[model samples]
Target: MKANPISPTIPLDAEGVHHGHLRLPYSRDDSAWGSVMIPICIVRNGSGPTALLTGGNHGDEYEGPLALFDLARSLDARALSGTVIVVPAMNYPAFRVGTRTSPIDKNNMNRSFPGKSDGTVTQKIADYFHRELLPRADIVLDFHSGGKTLDFLPFCAGHLLPDKAQEAKVFAAVRAFGAPWSMQMTEIDAVGMYDTAAEEMGKVFVTTELGGGGTSRAETVRIARRGVDNLLKHAGILRGAPEILPTRWLEMPDGCFCFAEEDGMIETTVDLGEKVEAGSVVARIWPIGRTGSEPHEIKANISGILVARHFPGLVQSGDCASVVATMAD
Candidate 1:
């Protein structure tokens, strides 16, 4: 493989506060020698574990980016024991346009992990993270929210990995994040996911769905800000102990998701964080083509709490409407 075209302006190993960009050259219609400059901040001190904290994996999600950018501006290198790499917006183009995927290649950033060196713009960014950034970190915390298409109860999460010890460490970080809920998350698909990439390297990883609707709230952002500090403390990268909070543990099992069966106006009976029983109607899709037509009812396959749901009013066939998750005992 050829060397990656992306170059960083700041040294990744320097001890002190440094800020710069990951410059990737892109020759487009506007300019023959144009480049995308993604903002990054590095804060380092003495010897300790590195915590690579990132946000804006998807463009529309704001909680992660909001908190991370604040931390980058306010964090003092003298108060740290190790390095903290902050990339508030991982998909800069997508974040600039406030979309889920990159505008340049229409590829989702999270799904472009372990990417090719010579590929699309999104892929190139992923390739750099896979090669340059992730290797230097002992722990990684990526933030996420519902974005425009979905909504979620504020929660920090980790997957059920095959490595028990690694999973334990990941879960410990998840709990230390101190969100309202701690989830054992299972993605519908995990191919090329950033979480997978970090975990495969045996790095302790945690992610979050703080809140959503293509926007963020004061409470959620507060959770995000505090969570990052908690994680650094948990990793021993910071001096203070994590601020402990009560968090309900939850898990999403297979068949717990409800999907729309037809296109129409969506009517959701259950709200987020609400309880529902198996076979209960979680949502309904009324036919837009005509009146007096029976709406397609989306029912819960298992009894659990409604952790997430589609955010918009309209629904299309095969779109996920609701996700019911059980209490993780």
Candidate 2:
């Protein structure tokens, strides 16, 4: 089995502002010997905590990449107290094509963590992060949004980690980012996620779900930029206090979610951030072509705010229609 040929151009320990690439060798029909260079930027100053910021873990998501690209271009490396490694497009292939998974291997970068060095292109990229990047960082902020399939209210979130101390650190970072909502979340599955990998290593990890629908918004982008600055300050790598904002705390204790039972056209009555009660109808799925059949009502299992919902009109059986967030203590 051949190993991944991807390698970083910039030295991780190098000082000052430097723009480089993670060069991944490719053998395609157009250019057999050419390579795809995933852009990366590094800012370093003295001895301080390192922050690794990434966006575009799934190619369709744009807020992370947009915010990180600006930071890469605008931030001064000489003024920093520690290192900031910015990878705006973690899945460059998917990002280039505007899809959630890589076109080459159809692998989700977020689910390819602690990846195989001898695996597919997506896995290779994940392998590099797992082996070369994560070890050097004291904190990590991975940006995310709902992408094309769903929309989300702007929020910074942390998982319900087992390690009390690490969980506390992650919570602090989440609050520090200061979005309108702060989520203490539990995923349906965290087996191979990048978040799982980071949390497992006890790194202070924070992620965000800004506005979604496969595009960037002025407000979400602004939140991303402000959150990054706040995170750096909170980590003591930059000078200044974290920007204070009133954040509503939300939680998903058991990953309770609403799913469609039949394939049809969905009409969601509630919007993101709207409050709902348990057993209440959140959405109705109607017949796509025929109008005689009764619409199936999708109901919430618990009372909470509507944090995310399906964006597309059409849906398949078992597709997640909505997710609710309860107020957290």
Candidate 3:
């Protein structure tokens, strides 16, 4: 593999707090000699565990970036014992315009992991993380929320990994983060996810799906803020006990979602956190083109709580209507 063109403006290995950018050369029609400068903050003390905290995996999500940007500005190096690397906006291009994928290459950053070094803008960013940043971290927290297409109940989540020991650690971290709900997630596609990359590298990885709708609420932002602090505490990177809170455990299995069969205006029958039985109608899609036609019903495939739902009023064919996650005993 060729060396990534992305270069960090701050020293990765140091004994104090540093704020800089991950500069990547980019040439476009507007500026022939322009670059993408991704902001980064590294706070390190004496040798200890390093926690890599990232946000804006998808440009539309806001909770992670809001919390992380605050952390970058307010975190004191004197109050830390390890390294805390914060990248508030991983996809700077998309984040700037509030899109889910990078505007430069129309590439979804979350799905472009372990990317080609000499590829497009998004691929180069992923390659930089894969080859350079991920190798130095002992624990990784990549923040996510339902973007413009969907909305979710605030929750901290971890995938059902093959490694039980690693899974245990990851779940423990999720518990320590203390969101309202703790989830054992099932990804529909994990081929090149950043989650898969970090977990494969044996790093304790935990992610989140706070409230969505392409925006952030103060409540969701607080959850993100407290969760990151608690994670640092749990990793022994910061000097404090994790503030564990009571959380309902949820399990999302594959195919636990209901999809819209036809495009129309979606009428949600169930709200987030509401429970529904299998085969129950979760949403109805009414045709806007013709008023007299019967609406298409979208039903739940599992008996569980509605954890996610599409955000927009109108729905296209094949859009997810709702996602149900079973209660964990």
| Residue 284 lDDT, candidate 1, scale 0-100 | 85
Could you tell me the lDDT of residue 137 within candidate 1?
94
**Best candidate (score: lDDT):** 1
The per-prediction CA RMSD against the true structure, in angstroms, equals 0.7, 1.3, 0.8
* Candidate 2 vs. true structure, TM-score: 0.97
Q: List the residue pairs that clash in candidate 3.
A: none
Give per-residue lDDT, candidate 3, residue 175: 96
User: Per-residue CA lDDT of candidate 3, range 151-174, in tens?
Assistant: 998999998888999999999999
User: Backbone clashes in each candidate structure, one number apiece?
Assistant: 1, 0, 0
Q: Which of 1 and 2 is the better model by TM-score?
A: 1
**Which 10 consecutive positions of candidate 2 have the poorest summed lDDT?**
1-10
The lDDT for every candidate, in the order shown, is 0.94, 0.90, 0.93
- Where model 3 places Cα greater than 4 Å from the true spot, the runs are none
**Per-residue error (Å), model 1, residue 299:** 0.2
Between which residue pairs do clashes occur in model 2? none
For candidate 2, the clash count comes to: 0
What are the per-residue Cα lDDT tens digits for candidate 1 across 1-329?
88999999999899999999999999999989999999999999988889999999999999999999999999998888999999999999999999999999999999999998999999999999999999999999999999998999899999999999999999999999999999999998899999999999999989999888899999999999999999999999988999999999999988877888788999889988999999999998888887889988888999999999989999778888999999998
- Worst-scoring 10-residue span by lDDT in model 1: 254-263
